[model samples]
Target: MRELRILVATAEAERLRGVLVMAAAQVALGGQATVFLQLDAVGLLRPPIEAPRDGAHQAAGLPSLAMVIDEALGSGVAILACQSGLALCGMSAEDLPAGVEVGGPIGFLQQTDDDARLLFA
Candidate 1:
């Protein structure tokens, strides 16, 4: 493929689940990837242990979002946290990973472009 550059946007639980899977696949396949988490999706980077799963009290056995992020980063994928969403969630840049940056609406632009393969989750 054209050295895949992917951007996934999601704030929904189910959508995030699917997007995570795709991100993992892309990284595993050696694609150049970036995930722009906006809205509630910004909560994903929170200290993973407290990460919610499908919005329930039950513990999800699947690898946490943080693990997926670490894996993606290990494979050279970039993860960005939306500035607006972080403010809405009461989060800050200090709370995110060193690899994650604060991006605004421009985050969306990074996710979708002429050569980028974009997916909105």
Candidate 2:
């Protein structure tokens, strides 16, 4: 299976949810998946994990963004937060959950395999 590399640069609720769902799907299929949260997106991972539209999702009988993130992590989906993004959001590595990694864009890109499908959200 091919690797799925997703670059999440926005804090938009809908888009971030999509990225997480996609990453989880990829992992369920026995593929490797990594989600790189950059820019404003890094703030979403901060404790309390405020994902906008979470209530709407719950109303629609869908899993909330936080639940999706947990499922993804439990399923072995790798999630990275950009070091600069954390600083930009006034956050530190300790602000994020245990499974999320802290790194830069260059390092994230360097880890991508030739056959990986890269996406930006």
**Top of the candidates by lDDT:** 2
Worst 10 residues of 1 by lDDT: 49-58
Task: State the displacement of the C-alpha of residue 25, model 1, in Å, after optimal TM-score superposition.
Answer: 1.9
Give the clashing pairs for model 1. Answer: none
- Could you tell me every candidate's TM-score relative to the true structure? 0.73, 0.95
* Position 110, candidate 2: lDDT: 95
Global lDDT of each model?
0.66, 0.89
- Candidate 1 per-residue lDDT over residues 25-118, each given as its tens digit: 7767766666778867787666642445633423445665556566667767677788888988888889997788888767558556687676
Candidate 2, run of 10 with poorest lDDT: 45-54
Question: Model 2, 96: alpha-carbon shift in Å?
Answer: 0.3
Best-performing candidate as measured by TM-score: 2
lDDT of 2 by residue, 8-105 (tens): 98888688789888899998998999999998889888788767788988999999888888888999999999998999999999888879899999
Error of 2 at 65 (Å): 1.3
